[model samples]
Target: MSQELPTRLLLIRHGESEVTVKQIIGGDQSCTGLSVLGRQQAEALGRRWAEGHEPKVDALWSSTLPRAYQTAELLAASLGDLKVQMHPDLVERRPGQADGVSFSEFTDQFEWTGDVHPYVPLAPGGESQSDFFHRTGKALYELVHSNPGTTMMVVCHGGVIDVAMRVLLGLAPAAPFLLWTLNTSITEFLTTDKIGVWRLVRYNDSSHLSGLPTHTDYE
Candidate 1:
C-alpha cells in the first residue's frame, strides 16, 4: 500500500499597509497599498524564498486588495516571478460604510457596543462575522479541493487566516480566541487522507525577519 501525500497550504499575511500607519479602516475601497517598511518586509520574505528557504510553491494567490496584491507582486518577483492569482474572497473583512474612516470616528458613528452579534454587519453595509467566515470557508474548501497534493501559497489578510485556521481545525465559529498574525508571517497547514483532517504545521513563522525592524498594527 502506498501512502497518500498531503496537500500543503501556505498562508501569508500581507505586509504593513498605509492604513495601518494612518490608523484607519482599510476596506477594499480604502486600501492604499504597502508602506515603506511593508515593502521591506515583503522583500525580505521574497529574498528568503529566493534563497531556497522553503519548498517550491506551485501556485501563488492573493487578495485583490492593493496591499495584498503589492506584497504578492514582491514575492512573485523572487519566486521565479510567479503570477499572482487575485481572489476577492481572500480580502479582509469588509468594513462597508465605515471603510476609510478612523477607528475613533467609526466607533462614534457606528456606536459599536464593544460586542456585536455574529450575524450583524460590522458596519452599515459591511460583512458580519458570520458572513466573513462563510466566505472564507468556501474559498478555502475550493482551494484545497482544486489543487490536491500541490503546495499553494496564499497571500491574504489576517482575518482570512484566522477563519482558515478555524475552518481547518474544526473549531467553533467565532471562538473566544484571537490570532494576531504579524505582517508577512507564514502559517502552514497540511491535509491528510481522512476527510476534514488538517494538520497545522506552523503558525506565525517570521524567522526570515531576524534583525529586521518590524512593527505590528491593527488589521
Candidate 2:
C-alpha cells in the first residue's frame, strides 16, 4: 500500500498596512495597500524564498484586499512569478461602515463595556466574530480539500490566520489566547491520513525578517 500524501497549507499574513500606521479600520474599501516598510517586509520574504529558504510553492492565493494582493504580487516576483488567485472569502473581517474610521472614532461611536457577544457586529452592518470565524473556516476547508497533496501559499490577514488555526485544531471560536502573528509571517499546517486531522508544522515563522523593521499591530 502506498502512503497518502498530506496537504500542506502555508498561511501568510500581509505586511504592515497603512491602516495599521494610521490606526484606522481597513476594510476592502479603505485599504490603500502596503506601506514603505510593508513593501520591504514582503520583499524580504520573497528574497528568502528565492534563496531556497522555504519549500517551493505549488500554488498562490490571496485575499481580495489590496494589502494582501500586493504582498502576494511581491512574493510572486520571486516565487516563479506564480499567478495569484484572489478570493473574497479569505479577506479579513468586514468592517462595514467602519471601513475608514480611526480607532479613536470607532471607540467613541461604539463603546463596549464588557466582552462583546460573538454574534454582535463590532461595526454597523459588519460581520460578527462568529460570522467571520464561520466564513474563514469554510473557506479554509474548501481550500484544503480542493488542492489535496499540494503545497499552497495563502496571503491574508492575521485574523484569518487565527481563525484557520482554530478551525484546524478544533478549538473554540472565541480564542483563549492571542496569536500575535507578525507582518509577513508564515504559519504552516499539514493534513494527516485521518479525516479532519491536521498537524501544525510551524507558526509565526519570519526568519527572513530578522534584521528588518517590523510592526506589532494586531490587525
- Overall lDDT per candidate, in order of appearance: 0.90, 0.89
Off by over 4 Å in 1: 1-3, 216-219
- In order, how many clashes per candidate? 0, 0
Q: In model 1, which residue pairs have backbone atoms overlapping below 3 Å?
A: none
TM-score of 2: 0.94
Question: What is the C-alpha lDDT profile of model 2 across 118-181, one tens digit per residue?
Answer: 8988888899999999998999999888788788999999999999989998888886878799
User: What lDDT, from 0 to 1, does candidate 2 have?
Assistant: 0.89
Model 1: weakest 10-residue lDDT segment is: 1-10
Number of the predicted model whose TM-score against the real structure is largest: 1
Distance from true position, residue 64, model 2, in Å?
Answer: 0.4
**What does the lDDT read for residue 201 in candidate 2?**
92
